[model samples]
Target: MKGRLVALVGPEQVELHEYDLPEIPPGAALLKVRRANVCGSDLHIWHFLSVAFRDIVMGHEFVAEVAELGEGLTTDSAGQPLKVGDRVAAVYYHTCLKCAACGRGDFSMCSNAVASMGAPPTSPPHFTGAFATHYFLSPGQFFYKVPDEVSDAAVAGANCGLAQMMFSLDKVGVRRGTNVVIQGAGGLGLYAAAVANRSGANVIVVEREPVRIAAARLFGAHHIVDMSELTTVEERTQRILDLTKGIGADAIIEVTGRSEAFAEAIEYARVGASIASVGNLNVGEKFELKFAPAWITRKQLRIVGVLRYDPWYLRDAIQFLADNGDRFPFDALTDRVFTMDEVIEALELSESRIVSRAAIIPV
Candidate 1:
């Protein structure tokens, strides 16, 4: 059998390639791509802005159906019965339990997290990215069967964006009655709002885009700080304070992918509060720090930089969708869809922000 994949050959360039599928190794599986989303990190990789990700597969967030199961594979990581054709979502990265970080129980920080994903598409078992028609699940990779109720549109992002937000919020202690401020109303921010709202926290989203502002409310934001109206750093800070009853946010989440948003998150955080820095992946001369070290020390803030989440969180994300999929418009998050041939268009639209979320159907 043959599978197709999208390969990044250079900055802002991609090519579609096809190769014979390799035999599924023991404890591994092969999945046929169903739905994939162009996540923010995809944009970064597309632009060659992400370190260690150049000339590789171009996607990570997706849901797939089991096309073939390797020998000795019978159940998912959660012990659920698995079979060919079962819908599943796998952690895009590897979690080598032998790694130092995994030995310390920090699976998310595994030293070889990208061992498989970092492989170039030209390698055997060439279907490594979600943008492709198939994905090869390496041995010991964590995957969960998707509930029958969750649409592919709703569950495609479970692996990356939604799962990461759930983990990030948990890391920062977002809970009932907490004033949680979300920076940016993009996919990550919207997911954060929905998670915080379901936890009974006061979800406050900060954004300038009208479409995203409306989407934020639908995703359960209790209040929104309109950047268009606030117009200044001081003004936005006062608004955040007002929304938090003069205490500032008990938890702040930064997902704007802008350096200024990181500095702005400090202003929105209350004393002793925690901030989850999930965006702003870039580093170097362009993304210089805009905030002062004194503020973090004086306020005693907890700033956590979250990358890909713990593998099991993908299971929790699927469960979250099963429990609350009807409560929020998860299907609507992807405003546009493109076919395998239109993958470039999908990337461009997502990069331009013309489509908040773009889905790729690679069948």
Candidate 2:
């Protein structure tokens, strides 16, 4: 059977290509995408800023249903029974167990992480990304079935933003009474806010956009540092200090995708504090850093740059939504929905910030 996929032809350009689906190999599966989200990383890839993803399939945040299970495939990564037509969320990246990183049990840092995600659409299977009619799951890929109580809108982001936030927060030791500051109020920031809040941390979000500021509050931010009012880094640092009772933040999360935000994170962090650098994926002179390395040595800060989470985190993200979906506005995160034909419009609107988040439903 034929399947269609959106392929990146150039910077800010995409084209729909149709090709016959390849046979599902043993221990693999094929899925029909039900809903896909346009995340901040999607924007990075759309602009050709990602060196690994140019001329490749265009999406990674999505939820799909099993269209066909290959021979010998009987259960999910968690040992749950799997069946055809079950809703599921798959980890977007690959983890080759034979790789050096995986050999040391650092699955998240697997050397071949983008093996499938960065493949060109002209290749066999031709369904590497979620912006497509079908997605091919190769052998060894980790996937988990979605719970019935969670809506597609709530679970679609579980694979990307939510899982990463959950992992990043856990990585930085965000626990009860920890003063945590999150920069930006995009999907990743919002998800970080919610996760930090649920962890019993004092959540403070730094955002400038009105809509996102309100979203930060909804997602359980105890305080919003309005960039409109406090326009300077020093002023914002004072506000953070004031909010933290002059101790500064115990943990800071940078999710603004702006290089300046990373520099500011150091200013907001207390001595011995940890910063989770989740954004700012681009690397070039344009995204250069001007901060001094002395600051890290003097303050003794822990900075972690996370790209993808361990595959098992997706399972935890699903369970998190199933347990707390009602406490936060997970469904409202997607402000706009578009069909396959409107993929370009979806990308444009998301890029222009006309929509906080966009969803694509394959026709």
Candidate 3:
């Protein structure tokens, strides 16, 4: 069999390439691509912002169907029965379960995990990216069968953004009646709102963009603050504080890519609170503001940095969508869709933030 892959070859350069798909080897599998999502990180890669990923395959977040399972592979990571034709989503990376990090079930922090996407084509099973007709999972890459109750649009982002949000919220231990402040209303922010809301937290989303503000509300944000209308950072923070009755946010999830957001995040959080920063991923981008080092120590705040997520979160993410798919506007998240041939244009649209979400159907 043969497969097609989209490769990020240079700055803002993408090309479709072909590869041969040998018979599924032991413990390996083949996924018939369904839908791959364009995430904020893809925008950076699309614009040629980093050199390490210049020659890597383009996408990492998607959902697929089990086209074929190889020798010794009949069950998913959770030991559930699995077979061809099953709809599924998987962790973006493969963990060497024997590593110290994996030994503790912290796959996201595993030093030995191989990222399925972003790997060079020189590696066998070159269909490492999801933006292709088929995706080949090398040995150790795990996947979970998605429940039929989940819609494709709702499950499309489960592997990346949704799963990461699950892990981020868990790290903060958001509980019932917890006042949560979301720093952005983009994909991750919206996901955070839904997740926190499901966990019985009151969510307040601060966003300047009108589209995302609307999206935040749809995603279950209890309070929406339009920063444009607020006028300044202090005013926006004060508005959030007011919503919490001046107690400030018990927890703040930073999903805004703006470097300055974290500086402001410190101001929004209450004493002895937590701040989980999953956004602000730009490399070498300088923050225009400054903070007092003593403030962090005085507050005794818990600060954590999230990378990807545990594979378990993928299953949890899919399940969350299945349960709440109708309650929130999951369908509206996918504002645009493109064919495999429109890869470049799709990236451009996503980069421009013209839509809340964009997808590539590679079937």
> Please, what is the whole-model Cα lDDT of each candidate in the order they appear?
0.91, 0.93, 0.85
The candidate that wins on lDDT is: 2
lDDT of 3 by residue, 1-363 (tens): 788889887788888888887478999899988999998888887777865466777887888999999999988877889989999897887788888999998889987655556578656778887888888877788788888888778788999999999999998878899999989988899999999999999899999888788888889899988888998878987898889998888999999888788998898889998999899777789877578978899888899999888878888888899899889987678889998889998998887777558999984
Measured by TM-score, how close is model 2 to the native structure? 0.97
Please list the residue runs of candidate 2 whose C-alpha ends up more than 4 Å from where it truly belongs after superposition.
Answer: 285-291
- TM-score, predicted candidate 1 vs. hidden true structure: 0.98
Query: In candidate 2, what are the lDDT values of residues 1-363, reduced to their tens digit?
Result: 888999998999999999998799999999999999998888888889889999798899999999999999999999999999999999999999999999998989999999999999998878999999999999999999998999999999999999999989988899999999999998999999998999999999999989899999999999999999999999999999999999999999899888889999999999999999988787863745667889999999999998899999999999999988999999999999999999999999988889879999998
* Residue pairs with clashing backbones, model 1: none
Off by over 4 Å in 3: none
What is the Cα root-mean-square deviation between model 3 and the actual structure? Answer: 1.5
Q: After superposing candidate 1, which stretches have Cα over 4 Å from the reference?
A: 285-291
User: Please, what are the lDDT tens digits per residue for candidate 1 over residues 1-363?
Assistant: 788889999999999999898789999999999988998888888888877888788899999999999999999999999999999999999999998999998989999998888898888878888899999999899999998999999999999999999999999999999999999998899999999999999999999999999999999999999999999999999998888889999999999888888888998889999999988787863755667899999999999999989988999999999999889999989889999889999988878878878999997
lDDT of 2 at 22: 79
Q: Alpha carbon lDDT of residue 119, candidate 2?
A: 95
Q: What number of clashing residue pairs does each candidate have, in the order they appear?
A: 0, 0, 0
